[model samples]
Target: METNEVFEKVKGLFVEDLGIDESKVTMDAKLEEDLEIDSLGIVEVVMAFEDEFDIEIDDEELADVSTVGQAVNLLHSKI
Candidate 1:
């Protein structure tokens, strides 16, 4: 998948599942700091991504992914 496609799908996941404003779901937006997603919410987001992309994301793989761009890059790489 293209980087932009990954970004858009991840952005949609954030907006739909987390109720985040699309305008604030920028490439640099921090998942915890900017989006205020708690630990449980993070798990939910991860699961949602796994379902949406039909890919598996282990916890270790997500340990350092704190930003939207980072998550997009990870997903892109997996695809």
Candidate 2:
């Protein structure tokens, strides 16, 4: 999938998993500060991404994914 499409799907996961407003889950949004996603929340998001993309995300990569755009780009590369 394209990066933009992956971004939108990740945004949906943020909404579903975190109860975040869809409007606020933009590409540049910081997962922790903007979306209030804690470490556990990050784990949940990673798991959701793994399921959605059918790819495994390692801990080091997950640590580096601090922004929505980063997640999009990472998923894009994997896809």
Candidate 3:
């Protein structure tokens, strides 16, 4: 899938599932700092991504993924 496509899905997970504000879900936004989502919330969003994309997501793969763009790039690569 294209990066933008994966981005929209990840954005939706943050906006819908995690209850994060839509405007804060930008590519450069930090998942924890900018979005104010806790670690557990991040895990839940990642799980949502795994389910939606039908792929396994290794949590360790996300250790360095602080920004939304990085997460999208990682998930896009898996797809």
User: What is the per-residue lDDT of model 1 for residues 44-77, given as tens digits with 9 covering 90 to 100?
Assistant: 9999999999999999999889999999999999
Clashes per prediction?
Answer: 0, 0, 0
User: Which regions of candidate 1 deviate over 4 angstroms?
Assistant: none
lDDT tens digits by residue: candidate 2, 1-79:
7777888788878788768898888889998998888988887888888998899989988768888888899899998
TM-scores, all candidates, are 0.95, 0.91, 0.91
The deviation in Å at residue 57 for candidate 1 is 0.5
**Global lDDT of each model?**
0.92, 0.85, 0.87
Cα misplacement distance, residue 45 of candidate 1 (Å): 0.6
Weakest ten-residue segment in model 3 by summed lDDT: 37-46
Candidate 3 yields a Cα-based lDDT of 0.87
Off by over 4 Å in 2: none
